[model samples]
Target: MDRTIAVEKELTPVIQYLSEKGYKVESIEFGSDYSKNIDKYDAVVVTGMNKDFLGMQDVVSKIPVIEARGMTAEQVYWQLNTSLKQ
Candidate 1:
């Protein structure tokens, strides 16, 4: 399962951990325009601070968006896997 994940630039730990776990991690800005490339990723990880700032909506993507607020990198990884599985 070669999964590609787009993670906010601030989530360095999550990025490194996911990358180490063999997921193709792409670092993205928090408020940058991602709607154009959202379809390319299997999942997206965010800090949860800016919910509507990513310019992405539920209607725009069916991919899972994991919030990394109270969750650790490992938890986020598992969430990604679980979401993808479902």
Candidate 2:
């Protein structure tokens, strides 16, 4: 299956960078829009700006999730690549 990363508004840079690296990523800003289908992605990357998602920790926990706090686009780029190997 192809890989994807669930993201939000503030993390568009992360998504764009990941896309350049060949990852299929989509961003959903509304917390209410998050669904089980998000789990189909290789991972779910949450931006620090999205405090709304904090309440959905239960669902987010069901996948290979990455929550970045004030992390730069470069950091997320390297982080995702690094984590995918483990």
Candidate 3:
């Protein structure tokens, strides 16, 4: 499945690199204008949540969130891999 990831900045080097390799990455600033429905995406990737969107009740459990903070690429990769299986 293709995953839609949200990054704070556009073409962020960190996210860009991941996208170049094969990740479906998108840039979105929560509570601001966005190109698409943040929840419509299969999976959500947050690269350090902003105060406005981080603690918002709407996002807390609406979907599966893959927080970029407090997580390593290895851990994320494994989680994604395992999720795909189930």
Candidate 4:
């Protein structure tokens, strides 16, 4: 089955790359909307920017949350894939 992923809006390169790889990609920002429907996605890619300031309050899930800070899109993909396998 094609995996669905929620990615941060700023990660355009990552989004495109993942989409090309046949995953259903949805652009998302950390907020009420995402928190409400977090379970729908297999994983989430976050920028990890201002996480402390912005706060992901009350948001919790078993899915992997990839911090795409300095990592390349390929690296992020690898990590995501790896995490899901286990």
Candidate 5:
């Protein structure tokens, strides 16, 4: 099965990179609704600049999340890749 990842809409570069790399990527807007649907993805990535946009950390406590703040797409990709390996 293909591993699916959920990326915040603000991280367009990361989203594009992951999509190009053959992972199933889903664009998600941060809000109350996001928490409700978090289960649909294998993991989540968000720009750490704005935590308020993502509702609350408690909502995603069980999900693996990568904070891609101030990082290049390549760096984000490698971080994601490493996370998946574990």
Candidate 6:
């Protein structure tokens, strides 16, 4: 199955890179209600600096979250790819 990833809005470069690699990518805002929507994705790529914006820990515990802070688009892509391999 194609890997579906939810990427935070601030990581536009990462989104573009993932899209180019053929992964289904969705843009999500930092403070949005992700409880109902998060399950649709296999993983989430967020900025480490904005990790708290997703709200309570319970809401994000459902899936693996990859922090993209201080990383390039290629690095983020590799990070997400590695996470999926485990």
Candidate closest to the true structure, highest lDDT? 1
Predicted candidate 4 versus true structure: per-residue lDDT over 1-86, tens digit per residue: 48999998999999999998888999877776567678888998989885631245555678888899999999999999998898
Residue pairs with backbone atoms closer than 3 Å in model 1 (clashes): none
Candidate 3 C-alpha error for residue 69, in Å: 1.4
Q: For model 3, which pairs clash?
A: none
What does candidate 1's lDDT look like per residue over 20-55, in tens digits?
999999998845467776778899898999878466
lDDT of 6 by residue, 16-68 (tens): 99999989999988565876667778899988886475666556455678888
Q: Give Cα distance to truth, residue 21, candidate 2, Å.
A: 1.2
Q: List where candidate 2 sits over 4 angstroms from the true fold.
A: 50-57, 60-62
lDDT of 4: 0.84
- The true-versus-predicted C-alpha distance at residue 12 of model 3, in Å, is 3.3
TM-score of each: 0.88, 0.72, 0.57, 0.88, 0.84, 0.85
**Clashes (candidate 2):** 0
Off by over 4 Å in 1: 56-59
Clashing pairs in 4: none
C-alpha-based local distance difference test score of model 3: 0.57
Q: Give the per-residue lDDT digits (tens) of candidate 3, residues 1-86.
A: 37665555532664665576576766666664442366665555566545455445444445556566776665665565555456
Residue 62 shift from truth in candidate 3, angstroms: 5.5
Worst 10-residue lDDT window for candidate 1 reads: 52-61
Q: Write the per-residue lDDT of candidate 2 for residues 1-86, one digit (tens) a residue.
A: 26777767677788788788788888776465566456566777776655557346555444656777778877887787777777
lDDT of each: 0.86, 0.69, 0.57, 0.84, 0.82, 0.83
Instruction: Tell me the lDDT of model 1 at 25.
Output: 94
Candidate 6 TM-score to native:
0.85
